[model samples]
Each structure stands twice: as structure tokens, then as C-alpha cells.
Target: MSKEESFQNSVIRPVIKMLHDLLAVHFKHYMATKKLEFSQLSEKEKTNFIESSFNKDMAFRSEIRGLVIGHFSTEEFLLYATMQRGINKRINTILKERISSNRQNFVE
Candidate 1:
């Protein structure tokens, strides 16, 4: 597969999976801070909220990015440094997909 795909599968996905509980906790805090009633939203609205949060909230996006990047090895980080933009997009996309798929986990 491609370099990006390889890095994503080996590094990004594992990081995301490993930090799943932390991500959920952060999402709950984000909802509380924003005064959003996450549990009240329908499935479709929940998905939309996840998409909109990443699109509109730079701080939340950055926090999520840091959580993933902080787990990378020295060599993996060096490779990521060479293609930050593309890797960032991949990271965000994967994060969005994971959060969207696991919306129930975010609710208390």
C-alpha cells in the first residue's frame, strides 16, 4: 500500500484505538462546554455534530490531533513531519469516522 496508508494503519489507527476512552471523555467535555445535549440528538444529528465540531472548532481539532500525534514514536514522528498536511487530513478523517461510528460510547 501507499506510505500514507501504511502510516495510518500502523500508527494512526492504533493510537486512536488505544485512546478511545480518552477521546470519548474529551467529547463529553466538549459537549458540556458547548452546552450541547449530545444524548438528545438523533443518530443523524449526532453524526452531523461530530462533523461540524471538527470543521468549526479549531481547539477541539488541535486537542484531538495532539492526542494522536503524542503517541507516535520518534521515527514515526519524523516521517509525519515530512507530510504534515496530508497526514493531518488522514488523521482527522479517521478520527471523525471513529467518533461517528462510536457515538454511543460518548454518552454517559
Candidate 2:
């Protein structure tokens, strides 16, 4: 398949799905281990938690970027970066909403 086609069907779609699953799993584990809903976290704790999670996720994405650059052409690499940014933006929105809802759960 062409790079664009392969990227859409194989890379972007699967990666986005995987990222969502990863986020869900991580959040569940985090809450379980902390024994507190998001709202229960202090402001500093919340900052730390978000930073830690963001770093882990960014590291994962960096590894994927490295592998893609090694296997794909330069043009495809650019495309991949652009698509990744867009995908991540959407995921960020979902994460914010998830966190907000988690906080609300504790409020009620």
C-alpha cells in the first residue's frame, strides 16, 4: 500500500486506538494504587500525576516516532508527525473530559 494509505489504515488508526486503551488502563491503575479519585488529589499531587503520565506517554510516542522514521520515507515521516499531533490533540481532549468526570464522581 502507498504510504498515505498504509498510514491511515495501519498506523494512525491502530495507534490512536492503542493510545486510548493505554490511557484507560493507566488511569484505572493509577486510581487503584492511589486509592483516591482525581478530585481527592491535592493540587500538587495532581500536577505531579499529570506530569508523570504525560512523560510516560511522550516517551512511548517518541519510540514510535523513531521506528517510523527508520522505516518510512522523510515525506512520510512528516505526514506521520502531522497526523500524530492531530491524534494527540483529540486524545488530550478525551483525557481532560475523563479527568473532569472522575472529579465530578467524587463530588457526588
Candidate 3:
């Protein structure tokens, strides 16, 4: 493996996998309360794509598994993972803008 690959295997990969797993659970729970799919990702169809692929080598997507995930119904366990992703994405976006504004002020 390249040095970067080795490093990821030793560090980054596991952390990402854990994050994916946690997000999977959160998404599962979030959808349960909502009753139906979020509607944003209806084209993707599979609710647990993010959760199920955490363990897969690709770290994200593969067609057969995705098709299978599409068949999997939502439950308390499934929605929590995706919900966590959504929350994280929002927080990160806010934080990024905050950091950028702070940097601009410091430059002035």
C-alpha cells in the first residue's frame, strides 16, 4: 500500500467507518419519527446506503448492495445514521462560514 493508504488503514479508515456506523443509526431513528422517506433522496431510493456501505471496501457505494438497501425498510435503527450525517453537514457548513468570516476579519 502507498504511505497514504497505509495511514488510512491504520487511522482514517476506522474513524470514518465508526462515523458511518453512528450516522447510520441516527438516520434510522430520524426517519422513524418522520414516517416516510425524506423525499430529497427519493431518486437514490435506498434508505440505508450510507449505513450499509460503511463496512464495504468502497467506503461508500456499490450497486448490488445499494439495490438491496433500497429494499430495506426504515426503522429506529436505520434513520439515525443518516440523520447524524444531515446534522453534521449542517453544523460543518455553519462552522465553515463562521471560520471564513473570522479569517476575513483577522486579515482586516
Candidate 4:
């Protein structure tokens, strides 16, 4: 597979999976802080909210990105730094999918 795909599978996916619970909690908190009634939204709307939140909220995006990136080793980080933009896009996409698929985890 490609270098990006390798790094994603080897590093990013595991880190995100390891932190899945934390991510869910953060998502719930994000909805609360934004005064969004996450439970009230339909499945489609919930998916759109997840997409729009990442697209529109830089602070929230960065915070989530930081959580995943912070777990990378120095070597993995160097690799990521070399292709920051592309890797970041991959990270966000994976994160969005993870969150969307695990939507049940966020329900109170």
C-alpha cells in the first residue's frame, strides 16, 4: 500500500480507536457547549452536523487533531510533518467516519 495509507492504518487508526471513548465524550461535550441537542437530530442531520462541525469549526477540528497527533511517536510525527496537509485531511476523514459510525456511543 501507499506510505500515507500505511501510516494511517498503522498509526492513525489505532490511536483513534484507542481514544474512541474520549473522542465520543468530547463530541458530546462539543454538542453541549454549542447548545446543540444532538439527541434530537435525526440520523441524517446528525451525520451532517458531524460533517459541518469539522468543516466549519477550526478550534474543534484542531482540538480533535491535536488529540490524535499528540499520540504519535517522534518518528511517526516527523513523517506526518513532512506531509502535514494531506495527513491532516486523512485524519479528519477517518475521525468523521469513526464518529459517524459510532454515533450510538455519543447518545446519553
Q: Top lDDT: which candidate number?
A: 4
lDDT of every predicted structure (CA atoms): 0.91, 0.53, 0.37, 0.92
Tens-digit lDDT track for model 3 on 7-93?
334433343333443434444553454464444454344324333333342422332223223333464225434454443333333
- 1 or 3, which is superior by TM-score? 1
Better of 1 and 2 by lDDT: 1
Clashes of 1: 0
Q: State the lDDT of candidate 1 residue by residue for 1-108, as single tens digits.
A: 989989999989999999999999998998999999988888889888999999999999999899999999999999999989999999999999888888888878
The whole-model C-alpha lDDT of candidate 4 against the native structure comes to: 0.92
Query: Against the true structure, whose TM-score is highest?
Result: 4
- Please give each candidate's TM-score: 0.95, 0.32, 0.26, 0.95
Q: Model 1, which residues run further than 4 Å from truth?
A: none
For candidate 1, which ten residues in a row score worst on lDDT? 99-108
For candidate 1, what's the RMSD?
0.9
